[model samples]
Target chain A: MRRFFAAGLTLLLVCAATALAVHAADGTVYGKGVTLTESVPIADLMADPEAWVGKRVRVEGLVVDVCKKRGCWMELAGGENQPAVRIKVEDGVIVFPLEARGHEAVAEGVFTRIVLDDGLGEAHSHEGHDAESCRKETRPGVIYLIRGTGAIIR
Target chain B: MAGSAPRANHRVRRWLRVIHRDAGYLAVGLTLVYAVSGVAVNHVADWNPSRVIERVERPLDLGDVRTDDALVDAVGAALGIDTPPARTFRATADRLLLFWDGMTVEADLARGMATIETVRDRPVLRQVNLLHLNEPKGWWTLVADLYAVVLAFLALSGMFLLRGRQGLAGRGKWLVGAGLALPLIALLLLRGGP
Candidate 1:
């Protein structure tokens, strides 16, 4: 009876050790990069895009939208009238459903440029007007688009 | 009666041990895959997972480019359009319209120039993302359902792995209680319950 009890105890210890190892490995593999706080503003990101490229950085904000089909893009609000940055899901990253919108999040990933247009000409033409009219209408709402890659949506 | 009872008890314990060990090992990798992907998917508005690698501008000489077949062909050639343009229009006085890959582009007529931008999805994570949704259909959905069932089993079996004071009756009970309470507390604090 004593021998049986000792053997059972050993088996339980082994299982516990295995579980701990698995959990530790996951944290090491996926938890790469730095945390984001309110002090680190969008202006700071724009100031040094090259250095931050391909490096994971976290940002917190309120979600505005999610893709109805595949979760391709999500809009995050910074402040009122401030152009919302549309966060794109990295190729393999899976985000949750639309219910997550309006929820605050801290996401980590590399910041990259997603310029929708190289010039203002596309914006001007879409409104069915000349350069002056396009400039008058589109200029006010112009937004510079930047996307993050390998993002973990928290 | 006692002899027969011992044999049956031994058989039951043996089967339980085998099932617990095998299932635990099989679930390790899959558990992490789904957990990480699920968290990322849940918070979509926070970030883009894909990266835009490069953007280039190529100049073309359309030379009085008009809103006709010839102009479209010239524009297509200059922009390196792999397939026929999905749509084209007169975007403005100096620009012509073109659309591809869920985006619109405008080319300058006189300069024969257009900007070409390409975005490539991030590797590994992109495929994992697809698995998270089981979007491919047929076999994938079946696999996802199986995974869900296994997860439920894991939760249940895990409770019985230990016994006695340090096991489910004492410390184990406390651990399980804490696990349940954490999620309940978060739901109450964050969403105010339903």
Candidate 2:
């Protein structure tokens, strides 16, 4: 009886330690030292037309929304046209603050490029469809898309 | 029957130990993969740690929207496609749209400018991310669900694998407590305000 208890206890500790190690490593690699360029204070990256266009700079803000599926994209607090950088979270990296939309966050990635259709520029154009579908057909060099690895949300 | 019982009990215990240990080892790597991917994906608004950079350039003229058909033909020619364009439209007088490869292309019809953008799917990470998200689908979802249950089992069984002062009752318990507390504290801080 005592031996069984001991074995169980050992297994538990190992598992816990493994979990901690996994979390620690992920946090260090993905959340420690990332920066972005853009000082806009809105939630939608498309809202701010000038601040984000044709520029590469780092900005700090909050995460306003996240995708439930494969975490394809996230929204920030910059506004409609000149919002904070909309992050395309890498497929396998795990981020913190899973559920809170209004949480303060700091992201570091390139302000590359994005191009939206002129017709869908109006706010009400995408009423029933998902937001991803509303994005204008993505063009190559016409828009800036940020790509980064590290983020911290307080 | 009584004489055979001890041997059967011994055999069962041995098999249990073997299954438990081997399963634990097999699960360790996958656990890390899922756990890391899960946390990163949860906070999608935060940032992407593993992003690949890509660049594309196409030479074309954007001065005339009426010549857009020629532009598409040129693109199709460049891509070595002989089939008629599945569909074509103008995103703008300056921008021409082309559809291919389950993706869309937008180009400047007048300026000879073309931009190609596609979501970069990280190699192993993409599949791991799918598993972590638990998308309700075919066998993958079922496997993920099973992995979740196994993780719970591993966590519970792990507590017993150690012994004495370093075991669950001592240092083990402390470590577990700390692990649980860290997330809880973060949650509390995030909630803020009464």
Candidate 3:
């Protein structure tokens, strides 16, 4: 009887420990879809992003930020003077990890510039929760995006 | 009249029993799947419910590893795997990362240490958990809706299964009421909090 109780206690402890690990996002993500054939440095692409617009090209760079809510997109740093580009994946398809910041990543996608309106621009911000805040108006500057089909992060 | 009423009651009870039992039987497989995965997922901290992460460590003889290719080759040779990485990058002077589908290798150039980490789907758990997770879209969602209908049918059929002293009018009502109250009480307690 004592042995059975001890075994049960051990099993409970093991299960409890396992539960805790599932809560946090593990800093790991699998590569999605095709391994893109060619990659360009983020610095070079930022210089002539328009040239690569609508073209599928891979880019490797240091990841600066990731969406805290859903891992649907990330921002990768470019050259010192260049604006970091956002890499957006289709929702429920390929999810980027929230813990991918500071890691080097290679993404392959179409590079395009989007003109932001109050509705669309605020949809991409972190604090744009409510309908009012999500509709926060901003000047229509170019929002460079590398809408990625596949990615590898480390 | 008395005999006819008893016969009608008996017939209704028989049909209800058949429906409840059959529905319960059909739901057994899904119930077990949901229950097992549910328990595993609830803890969220102790283990990875979706994938089992397999880790292997090795020491690389980084003799002349200067370029990214050389570093990948060294790690690959250490692990004795032939496939080239999907992507490789040097994050810092001391660190290099090689990525493949479901796998990652980190090389510490300064320490000559290398580690390969891979994730594997956890057998039955992964498949069942997919339904539990609602990550699988499209037709599977429709199947889940069907399952919900079965559940509602079972719950309603069950309430009508018993009669007399052992029925909903007696001890059974108290049990069912407690079952309903528990979740409501928990919700109330949690409403003002996190």
Candidate 4:
């Protein structure tokens, strides 16, 4: 009886460990897990982004690109033909991994718009990418940026 | 009085040895962890210490796929995936990006070429790096602070560990001076740049 119980317990523990590993393989959170219950679609936010500016909102989309150097910012895919939005976080505060590029992410942040100087050609210096990299704009002069607080990528 | 002074000096040295031995043992594991992670992170410009990224390019004949959905379907089929992509982006007229968990596909619609990138964590090193970077910064900050204090105690206690030849009063002082001078010299030389 004792031997049978021991064998059954070992099998149960093994099964539990395997289940956890499988679950953990799917998701990773940076900074904090998203708290906003409702998330706005990227298309809606892009339609009239000025209305959403300064408002704390949550958005969910597939991560199309991430900052290769510092993991500081990530570009999330919007609608099929629409432009993606840049979710920028503080350096070293929340590093969105490069592998997270293909994963779905729910991110919460305040949306802010920045106007660029054409001559100086400053393209979101925090990203450390090429100057033309902040091309996720629907318009020519303005850029939509989210000061991200937290995110969950799965 | 002379004997007492020497005895007091001996007692202080004995205590230093005891504290140094205990702290040294306690610091060994964390010291090794920080030292290894420090070297790895120091050269982060060259490589990602926590994750390994692999890229492959293959000739993918996506055919005459016009719509975004059709393009994603074709790439998924080529990549041996049954599920639809998590997201798709039409980066340009010629370039399309398909994203999935742990994988990304960048395709050139005009050239029929696809570049796939996949990423995976580097196991124990990833966790160690996180600790060293203080990524988990709640209770860990306190722990790290305590470790710093222990290390300081070890360094100060260590200076008095020996007596004459190999001790701080002898060649040990030169060794310590050299250790400190190297970093100062490097800073003086390289501080103007990176």
Candidate 5:
């Protein structure tokens, strides 16, 4: 009975610690050069992507997804079920936190639109996918982008 | 026949013991690594067991060279990335994908904002889980299979380590029986009734 009780206690403690660790890992702050300031709603900017293209803009939205390969880009959740806007940053310069998923972020960058071509070997590397899957999914499409220079993962 | 050699059975048993002991010694380090990572990975719902990725915010000023090659060159120069990307994919009109050996970059053409996210290993845990996950495929798979065979040998030889009171014929019988039965009991209790 004593051994059984001890085992039960150990199990309970382990379960609690696991939960605590996960909570602790949940919070990610990508604070460096990116600072949140005077951003418009993502929906508003995306509405006139052509007008915003080649123009610097700031937008705020909840992050629905992030590139798992590199924190190079993130998709901001759209308002009213609109498609999320993809914000791209130069790899290694301004990396968004992968853990920043489900958090809100304010991004300052150029709002631009591009017609992607299949000349690319692989598809857009989005949310944790292997290269094969990405290659398969790689197809020509139009995308709205924020050339994000600074971003704050709130 | 070779199989009919006088003490062939005894010789074979001796060889098995030698092989088991040496293989067990060699596998001890890997076993410990996987054992620790296994516990951590089993509760993946509670946490991420592999891949420690980090991101940071930084600024860039692009001087209008603006051509695709020049952009890649300029960004590579800015980041001080010694090697050029293996492939660069234009994902969208403004977004560029730069693929490196193990690193990647997403660049936006409209604005010169660059976000660099990199994969970092979590000290020993990353390597541990790599082995546990059998990540290094090809030759490593064969090696892992050999290790599995060795472990089976260890368990089997362990039962015969002693004789009479401690050997498989005696107390070892009960211990081994329980060891094997425990898993079945767990499976039935956890999966059968439901």
Candidate 6:
């Protein structure tokens, strides 16, 4: 009976630790929490997003915008004239607070470029926003974003 | 021998009833949270379940605020907001955005308009929705999984709680079949099910 009590106590403590780890430090960790150490400048990534496609990279920048509907994505500010790079996560997997805009964030994810066909003639919807509202499209058709795995917003 | 078999069956049914009742009691709180949040989330396409957002537009005349610092100070003064914004971004030469906790300002430098949007958590609903959505993962995941198991057990045990015409072998079976068929029918109608 004493051994069983001890084991139960240990399991509870482990669970407590896991819960604390999700919101551990000064910053709130979302999803699995950013793991990559090296940083890639948002400017550089936006300038040549295609080269980084399919590769996991970490980016640090000011959170300029977030998905208001679902908290599924955030736009990180790039350089002076460069458009912000979007870090898109699967909805509900990670919820970026609408208030996270303006805070500094570090996110790790695989860079991706989604090519839209002209034949479809439909402007893609980025979760809630219609094509007219989606500002991240590379040109008239392609969308460039990071398929985010985790992030830390300070 | 027939009496013994019925007696044993009655004893098992009694035990099942006790278990089902206790489990139902145990599940009340979490069940309420999940049920309410589930309905709110299902209609997420129509509204935000966790936060309430309000937007207001105010006119402000900041005579030619050129630099970033000047713009922040001017906007702060006009809005009577003493606290500095967390960050500011220049979306365009004519547009500047200032952000604070639960609040955002979109300033039209060309037109002297400030659109202030404030977001607030929806009281008890927000807290329950967080648990329902599994936002506080880790330990909560285990809690949710355990709740799911408890719910399954309660459902199965409930079928055996009644006997005769009201039991699984009678009208209860038809009710259960209808309950199961609804989802399958929905799948066929909506997703062209396998």
**Could you say which candidate leads in DockQ?**
6
TM-score of each: 0.46, 0.45, 0.56, 0.71, 0.43, 0.86
* Candidate maximizing TM-score: 6
Per-residue lDDT of candidate 5, residues B3-102 (tens digit): 5774776687688778778788888977897789889778654545556655554555668776778878887787778798765654456766565644
> DockQ, in order, for the candidates?
0.02, 0.03, 0.05, 0.24, 0.02, 0.43
Residue-level lDDT of model 2, residues B1-194, one tens digit each, is 88799788567656656767977876887788788787766755454433332436666543333466777887666655577655555444565556443334556655666655433556776656655664323344566777778888777767666567887888999999999999999997886321
In model 1, state the lDDT of residue B109. 69
Error of 5 at B8 (Å): 12
The local lDDT score (0 to 100) that residue A44 gets in candidate 1 is 53
**lDDT for B1 (candidate 5):** 81
Q: Residue A9 of model 3: what lDDT?
A: 77
Best by lDDT: 6
* Candidate scoring better on TM-score of 2 and 5: 2
Off by over 4 Å in 2: A1-154, B1-19, B39-59, B62-68, B74-87, B91-94, B110-112, B118-120, B191-194
Give the 10-residue window scoring lowest on summed lDDT in candidate 1 chain A: A127-136
DockQ of 2: 0.03
CAPRI docking class of candidate 4: acceptable
The lowest-lDDT stretch of 10 consecutive residues in candidate 3 chain B is B133-142
Give the distance in Å from residue B173's predicted Cα in candidate 6 to where it truly belongs.
Answer: 1.4
Residues A92-146, candidate 4: write the lDDT tens digits: 8887777777677889999987764443343445633332232323333667778
Number of colliding residue pairs in model 5: 12
Q: Residues B69-144, candidate 6, lDDT per residue (tens digit)? A: 8988999899889999877888778888898889999898888999998989999888888999898777789899
